[model samples]
Target: KIKEEINKRIKEKIKGILPGLLEEEIEKITSAKEEELKKGVERIIEDYQPLKEENKIITKLFRLLGDKTAYAAEKKPVEKTKIEIEIEWIELFNPYEVPCEVEGWQIKTSLGTRALGGIISSDSYRFIFNMVIRMPGKSIGKEILGDNGDTVILTNKRRNIVDKVSYRGYGLPWSAWEKNDPRSREFASILPGGSPGFRNWFWMPEVGEAKNKNDYSSFYVKDKPFANTGEIVFIHSGEWRTIRLEQGGEWQILDKITVADPPEKPVQGRININTASKQVLEALPGIDSALSQAIINYGNSKKRPFNEIGEILQILLLARLGSNGKDDDKDGYTDEEDEREAIFRGLSNLITTRSNCFTVISRGEVVKNDEIVAERKIKAVIDRGSSPIKIKYYRELSED
Candidate 1:
């Protein structure tokens, strides 16, 4: 009954203005845009069907207006709900600003939409969101924008669009991407090395610098060597640590990955796989102590040094690389390759023996729906070739 009452009132309002509105907008249909206008008019005309016999001119005039403006005179208007959401900051673009109030609003990206924890106070006039848009629930990916074109929409409780960002044609990526560095969201405004978050490391490639800065590294005795992180004998699968620099110019532990509840693969700047000790290898996913040993043994046995990281996948047969640069496992690939082709089968940014730069990829199991499951990849690079492995380049891989 309330809906009917609203519609009746809306119709009366439309009838009052239709005559003037039609005079302003009605046009002869010619091109595609004109045809679209005609269709919109026909939609409104349909609402007043009885007018076909009562008054043709009155019905035709409706074509000059939008469906809502023309047809409200005949049909009920469903009250469309509205919610106001303010885009606070885009981490890849405006990360330096204050974090957004993302409690209640829902964010949708090309990858998927995740709901906020509803932990924000909404008494203010606006809602802000610093949307990460990572996978929410059982969805597929978190890189929501598309290459050709994409739209990110913010909606309220009733799913009415509050705000949206739309882009068309092939443009810039949402984050920066370097050859061996993690493939970050290539935001249109962000260049390859420019940090949209207003921060970027000075590429320090010298090991002396890394040591001067008191960073961690494996001191090899020229072959039968191993690695340790100052305290641990060898890095464990979950032993990978995320560190940051302190004001005193020393490396400080920012967070450590817990085996029971590991964070998404912590990005490790490249640890020269060519020179990285077995202990270091053990810290990576799909690698146990035994596999690490085997990798070391295999390194000795190979005839030629790997030309590139992807070549190691072929040497270990972890992934069979055809000339075309794709994993051809359908012909019978197993083990890590068989387990998952996307991560294990390729070493695009890994497995380098000479560049003296390396990346460590780690994945952790997180409980989702009461079950432990694995998630995305992150990479970090350390260029030992530099006089002082400048700075460890680490970043989470964008899912686009």
Candidate 2:
């Protein structure tokens, strides 16, 4: 009777404490939350016969512990940013296909992103934007917002979603992409330090905003802003129209394009390769009448002829063996496009497609009462056909 009573008490104790113990054990083993733990506990009890002493409830319970525990807290998933800044209504555009309507909308991008453009690489160049920016209601020169990792937002009085652009350049690089619907580009394919914003490529102001160019010219002029350098008239061999400067900055037809080299001397003499006849070509040192005719014929043959002086040299080199009928690129341009395109047009050297000025030098003696007193001469590009016959320069010459 004593053994029977003891066994009965033990059984009662196991039944009473075992449920609570199982709950605690399951909770510890599985990092599951309250709901998931409850479900798991019910499953274990239903599948294993807990009341039978001979059953492998303990063994099965141990096996359940090995079924991947979920004791650690769950990490929340990151969601995409839902801002209304990207616009994609237009069919085709630049950089990003769609343009943003930023009239009242204020931007929040790095200051470095405002204006950026230059030689993107040795092989190609990129042009962006150049602006003297001002905020509404702000003073002319007053400074405003836009630093790295700053939030760029556009909102009206109601705080309604107008538009927004945000970037994090405190770390890697990214590209500013415009699409109809936006999605974060996978970083796996992006290069380190890649920036994807208009104004935040390198975040150093050097890479420039996706919109600004440093204003380089293949052949630049003097006493003028970089903008004044005129366009080169590239005559296509096959077409009868001039190719735009926007079309041949890469010079796919010309093997190696050269820029405004070493800056033309301020008072330097420039010969228009396009209009210069055979005689004028002979006037330039190292050029003969044969090369001059070649230049003229090359220009006359194309619709938009000789947009670049480099093209002139290039064609001269190609025609060295004298017209082999070897049309490499099949684009009609055989040589120089004149002075319109400089590989830095307005930075230093000056060449032009048009010649409104002519430098004339008249050698004569300044005589005093018939005896030659002094020798004098002047070199200046005459401002020809103006209201007055303008003599461009006047100076004393050494008459020895």
Candidate 3:
């Protein structure tokens, strides 16, 4: 039946041939175009409902026909949908000499919105941490200040926006980057880290020459063999030690005495209090072996790591207030309030609760009829410490 139908259709297609053509010439032309006729027959059979009634006959007929032509309709190229996210910017533009209280201000990020407290001193910057802005029970580093990229929005107490900024995490931490500047955010020459609470290190501090003789003189006097009255100086014995001149102006150095070196020079850069080891913590000023161990203990005992630098004071206060010189969780302070405060204040600028880098993975897909037709994934390493943020590394990923 299929063969009869195909032959009838081919004859109908040949009916318009010129009258000059003989029967044999028409037969030759029809035979030469048999393949073309087959394709047309196949399409017609598929479209004709009556021909589709019998699945077996349809299948047999298609087998008799040739494979599809290259010109046949090709599947539509895979198209991916675009994803958009809302972002807000933050900027402070106060020129008043007096400090402005930012209490009740709000910071909105991709993760969520966080309220601000405390004052932003005139001509100074305040670095707020995720712990202060994130909702309770949220993780510190990943929640608000997205390690990969994020939009930051600042609103005043009246809910009016002050400023906003968007950044893609990429360059090294501590390096300065300005939006208007043509320079790249990633600086290969500078090491990782940044000046968060202060100005960028690229600028030099304005220092004037000493105006008075006293200002030019060194705090410690040298070249004088005999110590002056009420003078304190370092004496070299078996080990360097400090000696004071009494009322008689006489100073004696201890023989074969061992002493630790004086405090190290102040170092730049901040350490993540959430991840630093006890040994690393001890390297900071006012943090001795005992205090370092207390910090570690406090960090471990808590459900989460330190969310802000100020939280370290709670541990220091507990250590200072504990009885018998043992670390404890005592609630009140004693005569050691000043000492504890000194320790906390010393570390305020040297510690951070979040990491400098973050990894972000994003996947995109094209879907049809509830099934994924095409997919692509990307992995990026973002450096949040840089002023404008940087993408340290990026690569396309695949699913095995």
Point to the candidate with the largest TM-score. Answer: 3
Candidate 3 weakest ten by summed lDDT: 63-72
Model 2, TM vs. native: 0.23
**What tens-digit string does per-residue lDDT give for candidate 3 at 2-67?**
335444433333332223435775566456445644554454334233323333232121111222
CA lDDT, every model vs. true structure: 0.36, 0.33, 0.45
**Candidate 3, superposed: residue stretches over 4 Å from native:** 1-269, 274-307, 316-318, 321-335, 341-346, 354-356
Q: Report the C-alpha displacement of residue 113, candidate 2, in angstroms.
A: 7.1
Candidate 3 residue 351 C-alpha distance from true site, Å: 0.9
Worst window of 10 by summed lDDT in candidate 1: 201-210
Q: TM-scores of the models, in the given order?
A: 0.23, 0.23, 0.25
Sort by lDDT, best first: 3, 1, 2
Instruction: Quote the positional error of residue 374 for candidate 1 in Å.
Output: 55
Task: State the lDDT at 351 in candidate 2.
Answer: 36
Count clashes in each candidate, considering only residues at least 3 apart in sequence or on different chains: 38, 47, 16
